[model samples]
Target: MSPYYVSYKSDGTLVSGPGSITAIGNQTGASSYNNRTSGYLWCPTARDFTVGSGGNKGTTADLATRTASICYMRGLKERVEIQTSSGAPWQWRRICFRFRGNIYGASGQNSQSGNYQTHIETSNGYRRLLLQFTDTSPAGNQVENALTALIFRGLPGTDDWYDYMNAPLDPTRIDVCYDKTSTISSGNTSGKVFRKNFWMPMNKNLVYDDDEAGGTESSTYYSMHGKQGMGDYYVIDFFKAGLGTTSSDVLVFEPQSTLYWHEK
Candidate 1:
């Protein structure tokens, strides 16, 4: 179970489902797709990143009985939020995940016997998975990534946490940061790497625009896909008092880690 990325079209088409981990960058954006402003886009919604040994998710395993990760989340909050140098915040549909002691399933893309679905919100202006992972050790960043959790507010404290095996009516959000390296020439030598925040950073550069498609491990991604694709990865943290301002705004109903979201 090697951890990999997934993609989808703006219309929510299943372009990269289970077993397509190695084919992420091989599609070679078609000329017709290049000119079009919207169509298929790369998303960062990582499923089955952690699975119980009971068996493939959604089949033999009982998600509620297992612990996908651990984090405290109240429905009243922003799904995803990013702070900046000016202290402005960027928000989106989000869910939270705890990376500490997390047993990442390499075949994270597989555990599922079929298409899995996590955050399914139908009660808001929009829908998304606001994932939150808290690591106080260190921030490991890469030169190239599909997305980067910039620290515009403040650094994480010693204690923080993400997702539970079973998400409730409302999900939580996680914030990941990776801009703390002495030299860009060298590699990020921090705890973020151990947390598995950033993916392969050696040969590929991450782009948010699907049109910027090209790379090896991760290529171009577009948020315009409308919360489609595997659900784009987001950088968020809006609840620490010492760092800056925080909130508990609700976006949509939180998603659960059921067969719909776990196995393939």
Candidate 2:
């Protein structure tokens, strides 16, 4: 059957026609039942990652099963530590993902069967996904620290080392970076939260370049590559050392929400 789109116009007039598909594809911001952007806001929790098909083995199709909680490794110490420009060792203290909707099935805003969720769950096109973060640390002074998120794409029983390292435009991994502010939270923690947003392409043909303004994905740091499919998982990596010069000197990462667009 040919595809059809249904959405309301800016004036609130309900409309459905062959052209509605193009209208939704042109949406620019967050995807909603009303906005009709070819996207969805994914709010994943610790549970979504644990119940998947991988069996928590961190292997080919089992990468999603590698974590018992929202945080990577259940314990951050297992993460590889890297040297920063200042010669101080930096490691990802806490990398995680949280969402209200399920990435599978007809849950939350997903339709039982329609173009909405299926666009992402079973099709390949120009797609994009984003994660929103806000630093709520006591000092809020993690300016030197860079926020990094890794987007891994694959399906259960179908992923392998070859696709992750050698895929053309749609590699199996994508690294997105953002900047942290140096300001301190004021009277209330919410009043001074430093917000950072990172967007990663969900399709191979799309390219996400690092911000040259001393941001994380700068030429001095890493390159961006990767895309997500039916099975998608994201992990945060903290780069730059000495958050506060002590074990407690760590950056707190709370993923506010995840947004994505599946473009035709």
Candidate 3:
């Protein structure tokens, strides 16, 4: 019997399937893939929803709102396994996620600018990866306080967020890969979509080796095996709290928004 399954609610209806590569990637082609190391997450466009204004400035909406869109990936606790140098077995807990989405003003404006963020919760809601907008000073004296902050946090048996910025690896320094604006036809109007893409740097310090008894603890290791949990299925929340008052001025999650990851 198959051991893995993924489930999520779409338009108040529950949908589920085996956690196989074909299923997870929503592939419509072959029965299987030769490369099982990577696949696309099965986030349906029907599951796509919007967040209104008046949310917390730098965070998502309340837990009740987040829980409504929660997705579950069972049998992921041990999807990837490895062995330490001491012959002890270990599950390499790393899977990188690539998020592709768009930002646009919900109002009928031809242009849009806003503070947007993507929040990913995993480990049964104990761990979080927050991809905030980056506030940078650009040319022409432009300021971007509207930009969000990228951060990682965990719940160490408490209700508070345990910051991971001070860690030696510095996982909080996430960078964007692509961002551009283009015009597209939306029904009868020529609408625009601001496409933004993000992928974590592979140079992160997620792997540690204590092979030498007295060697200095080093943190310069990189590998696909060291990627974090995209396999566990993530409850991803997109929030837009722009500095505007128009109810039409909102962030839109495009139907093409996707999560790509490598598995063991």
lDDT of each: 0.21, 0.23, 0.21
Q: What is the lDDT of candidate 3?
A: 0.21
For every model shown, what is its TM-score relative to the native structure? 0.19, 0.21, 0.21
Worst 10 residues of 2 by lDDT: 4-13
Return the number of clashes found in candidate 3.
9
Q: For residues 1-264, write the lDDT of model 1, one tens digit per residue.
A: 112222211212223221111101122111111111001111123222123222332223433221222111111212211222222121222222322111123322321222222222222211233222221212331211111122122222313312111112112222222222210111221111111122211121111223322652222212222332222332222211111222221111121111112222
Report the alpha-carbon TM-score of model 3 versus the true structure. Answer: 0.21
For model 1, the superposed segments whose C-alpha errors exceed 4 Å read 1-45, 48-52, 56-235, 242-264
lDDT of 2 by residue, 205-241 (tens): 2222223445422221011223312223333332222
Candidates ranked by TM-score? 2, 3, 1
Predicted structure with the largest lDDT when compared to the true one: 2
- Per-residue lDDT value at 46 in model 3: 17
Where is model 1 poorest over a 10-residue stretch in terms of lDDT?
29-38
Tens digits of per-residue lDDT for model 3 on 1-264?
A: 111122221210111122111111122111111111111112111111122233321113322122122222222121111111121111111222322222112331211122222222222321112222222121221111111121133332245432111212213433232222222122322323333333322222212211233653312111112243221122232221212112222122222223221212
Error of 3 at 58 (Å): 30
- Model 3 steric clash pairs: 94-227, 94-228, 95-227, 95-228, 106-248, 106-250, 107-248, 132-148, 133-148
- Best-to-worst order by lDDT is 2, 3, 1
